[model samples]
Target: SYGMVIGYCRGDHFPNVLYGYVMLAVIGGLYGCIGGGFLGLGLETTESKQPKWAQLLTEMVAGGMLAWGLLIYQLEWFMTPPRSELWAACLGAAIAMIWYMVRNKFDRALRVAIYSMLGAGFGFSFGNFIQGLGQASGLSYNWWNVMEFILGLSGGIAMAYAVATTKWEKTMQPSRTVQNLSIIFIFLILPLVNYFSGFTEEKIRDLAENLSVSDIDSFVLFQHIEAWLSITLFAAIGIAAWWQRASDRLQKWFSFVMLSSLSLCYTLLALIHKGFFHIELSIKNSITLYLPILFLAVWLGTSITQPWLNSSNSAGNKKIWQLVAGMTICIILIALISIYINNPTDRTPQRF
Candidate 1:
């Protein structure tokens, strides 16, 4: 999950320093929290374990301290330095480590295969990012796009490992499927939370000056909706998964696959913006492709738990399949609906 946050926060990837954007905006039940008290989902106050005002003040101070600290640090340490070269070094180390660990599995012939895909992804993302920054005065740079390949490779492998670990190992029980789903989800959920962080509005505003939108109204609407639903879907899936507790393994695995798929989707997003879309935008370019996989693959897989059927009636695992399936479908539909409704998009959109 922490790794996911870093992925979404990659400043070079997405504009607006979306890093801090999520922190201040969305916390659970923010709609109910007022002055410093938690009113919970119902917005009905319960006993204040801590004084409301004190909590509010403390949260404020902490947030301020943290933000200022980061600001100082970036300005002093990272911001003062050249980002491209620095980021490149960092990314290179990561890519090396991933290949180091996994290289044995591949024959020499397969080396180029992994690197090629990674290179293409790297070039596309970095190229766009540099183009955006090219016009900025204080933020001028002459970094190579190939370095972004290292960044992307590092990012991809790190993301993969992050997913693999939580998805594969987080299962209290033995189930690869559940763990994988959970791992991937943690990635998606954090960014979703960040979308509500309130940082986006400013980030978008600042970037919009450099934006090339002949139709500002349309683009503005898209920016809002894309950010909004991105977060909502993450929350829906996360909460629903928790409520279902279908299987930690399934949760991790599904999320891992989803993020992996999103990485690919991101590439598609870049291509679309540059190609036919000609809108100078990158939306959930991968979502339509990913949605069906969720509906059919994980949702259906959870339904047909083989171990449960193979076991005796008294076996506890028997009901596990039923729970997984039922929850998968219920959660998917509910989440899908909730995400679309709360998103920038319209509910019952006449044509999706």
Candidate 2:
């Protein structure tokens, strides 16, 4: 979902400058497009016997263009000269209007765009409110953290809405028990993980005093452990569900929820690094931060594709499985390449 992508891109909470905005736009757009393309390829079967490469390429390009155009518009409006909350509100309303007009025809595209814009507007407002509260309470203010929190929360809400509204085919419907279990997992278990993993001042102080570790070291260790545990739990659930032949609805729900929650957690961790402590993003600081989420994404992709491989009801099903398998491999390879590019080997902390 576009909301998920926007939330992930806000993890660093880029500086309020033209260059920073540009980077945010590019990252958000690319992430959304790549993710959307993969999902489309994995879930939808094509009637035309066109080459897989051509079909995938077309889908990717279309997704990229749509996300990039909308994100550019969003960033430019948010970052241009004389930024105002009023302007942000107006911009969000305008996008909502467009969404309404296009909802009947371009339902998917409009949903992503409208949700993203709405989330941005709400995040900005909530950030300002938090900043004010901090000032009034004589506490240290971290506007970036507030912004990240709002974006993550809003994005999660939007993605949840999308999942609820989707019209799944008869073959894809999950049993009531599975659906109820998903709701409990998402609404209950997820919030508990996030709450306990949150690096609040008290938690950090306890970690430091109890473990005799430096602040930065404790922060890094906590983040790494949390990411690994959370992602592993999600991947395990997804794999088990697929192996048990859970319905398509369950798989889809888990995928969207994992994506949304991962994005939220990623940004929350980043906010702890950059906002609370003023640490900069560097190889040593951020390399491991995103790795677990990427792994989870790839693992989920494999799980989704594996089912198609098992279903041999027709020649069409066989072809679909092959195409999806290729896509899954490609996604994993790209994630691995990214890990290499980010260079996770550096041990020195970028900041204390």
Q: Which parts of model 1 are misplaced by more than 4 Å?
A: 1-145, 152-189, 196-199, 215-218, 241-352
Q: What tens-digit string does per-residue lDDT give for candidate 1 at 115-183?
A: 222333333333333433332323333333323433344334322222222211121242567765765
TM-score of each: 0.29, 0.34
> Which lDDT values do the candidates have, in the order given?
0.35, 0.41
For residues 262-284, what per-residue lDDT tens digits would candidate 2 score against the true structure? Answer: 55545455544333233345543
**Model 2 lDDT, residue 108, Cα:** 42
Q: How far is candidate 2 from the true structure (C-alpha RMSD, Å)?
A: 18.2
